[model samples]
Target: MVERCKACGFCVEFCPTKVLALSSAFNSKGYHPPHVVNPEKCSGCDLCGMYCPDFAIYGYKLETGQAHVATAASAVHRAQRGPGNQSTGVEDEG
Candidate 1:
């Protein structure tokens, strides 16, 4: 989805972890899309996805020993359900 980006820099600018940076490589549309600079630093906050107008990027937290990628939406849903409500479709390996 990097090609779908419009070089708006919103994602890069708003990223709290500074995981993304504008790459020198251009997309098919001749726009400089973002690239992950420090993936380990990413907290999977999904702020990039929330700020992205093109929906080009999003973040997910990977639970240890789980096959599923917990997305931002699911995280929020889990939070709303409060503690002890681990009924998400993605199973926890622990």
Candidate 2:
């Protein structure tokens, strides 16, 4: 999947799972937006998207009696990090 990021970094500031981070380089807009630097600790909760000003991140999950839920933020996390999250970062709520 394409990053579809504008490098606004708003998602990073609002990511509850802290799965996203600001890239060192800038995007086409010359902004350093958040990205899935670790792809292993995402909880697929979609908190970031819920608070994103530009909806840069997305997450998705399948519920199979595991209590997992599919969300735009969760889908974005899954797209980059897969199903398991092993990384850790600061928990910022927008």
TM-score of each: 0.66, 0.54
| CA lDDT, every model vs. true structure | 0.58, 0.49
Instruction: Give the top-scoring candidate (TM-score).
Output: 1
User: Which lDDT value does model 2 have at 38?
Assistant: 47
Candidate 1 segments exceeding 4 Å error: 65-94
Which runs in model 2 stand beyond 4 Å of their true positions? Answer: 1-8, 63-94
Q: What C-alpha lDDT, on a 0 to 100 scale, does residue 24 get in candidate 1?
A: 83
Writing each residue's lDDT as its tens digit, candidate 2 over 1-94 gives 1235565566677766566676565556566655465455556666766766565555545352121222222222223333564233323222
Number of the top-ranking candidate, with lDDT as the measure = 1
TM value for model 1: 0.66
Tens-place lDDT per residue, model 1, 1-94, is 6557787888788888676788787777788877666544566677888888887777765453112212211211122223554433432211
Q: What's the CA error at residue 39 for candidate 2, in Å?
A: 1.5
Worst 10 residues of 1 by lDDT: 71-80
